[model samples]
Target: MKNIAIMGGTFNPIHIGHLIAAQCTSDHHLFDEIWFMPSGNPPHKEDEVIIDSAHRMEMCRLATKDHPTFRISDYELNRKGKVYSVDTFAMLQKEFPDNKYWLIIGTDSLFNLEEWYNHKKLLKIGAFVIVHRSGYDEEKSLEQQARLRECYNTSFMNVHMPQIEVSSTIIRQRVAEGKPINYYVPDAVSDYIHKHNLYQLGDDHEIR
Candidate 1:
């Protein structure tokens, strides 16, 4: 069976950290293909909205351009309303019944799994590959772990990668301050931001 991994996020400005996590998870989880799906509208954080869907998709494309196994997906971007993980998984499961789909996320997001839309059903459709982030607990309570084991048939695959605290918010703030964000994002993305003058506009400027 073909193994597919889905990495969904805002990706305001895809960074090296995100790339590393994707690569690590792809290898560790043994996924045949890893698709970076940029969410159109996320229900998690309203404070930091998504950048333009086109630009975000391009950034992800540039970030994973070097990896043959990595791909950029605009499935969620083309859809309207808040992007739900369950909805995406269901669609893929229906299309590829022979393939095993895995959802990649960070340690922080796992903590809020209960709040996600139809999270239980999501587990039934696909497995989860969570990346480690500092300050987030990797160890789960025995009771909770047991429940997850019974409910979703999950497995914990740990990866050793550099801990990068740089975030898209910081990248935007740096752009707003006229600071250099050279290494924070891919060179192509940085150039695109400059050419498009994104986040360089006034305080009221909306991120695409």
Candidate 2:
């Protein structure tokens, strides 16, 4: 059976941290393919200033182009209305009945697993790989993992990697401040952000 791992997020600008996590996860050889799935409209981040879906998708494409195992998926991008993890997993399960699916997330996400939309159903559908970040509470992670295993028979794995202290929000803030964001994001993404003048002050573009 094919093992596919999914790393889903808003990917507001697709930074180096995201790439490193995905690459380290891939290095484990736990999955046949690692798909970078960008959400169209993140329900949890409704108040945040998200960039256009087209641009986010393009940046993800550019960021993962050099990696043979890395791929970008438009599953959530093409879906209408609110996108939930359970729905995405269900669709993939139906589409690839022979393949096993795994959901990859950070420690922060693991702590809030119960708060996600239909999270119990999501856990029942596929396994989870939690990537440990610096300062993350190991005890809490283990507790949550055990709870899920006992309650839903969910499978879990932990991956350790060097943490990169970069976030899309910080990158956007730097751009808005007219500061250089070199090395924060990939070169192609940096150029795209500059060429398009994204995240600049007073630029009134509707975020969808």
Please report the candidate that would top TM-score against the real structure: 2
Count steric clashes of candidate 2: 0
Kindly list the per-residue Cα lDDT of model 2 for residues 107-175, writing each as its tens digit.
988878888899888878868989998898888889989998999899898987787889988998888
Per-residue lDDT for 15 in model 2? Answer: 94
Q: Which portions of model 2 show Cα errors greater than 4 Å?
A: 203-208
Clashes per prediction? 2, 0
Error of 1 at 146 (Å): 3.9
- For residues 1-208, could you state the per-residue lDDT of candidate 1 as single tens digits? 8988888888887887888888788666588898898888888768875567888887788778888899999988888987898898888888878987778777766667777888788666657777776665556733454577687886544555568879888998888788999989889889888888877646676543
RMSD of each: 2.3, 2.0
TM-score of every prediction relative to native: 0.89, 0.94
> How does candidate 1 fare on TM-score?
0.89
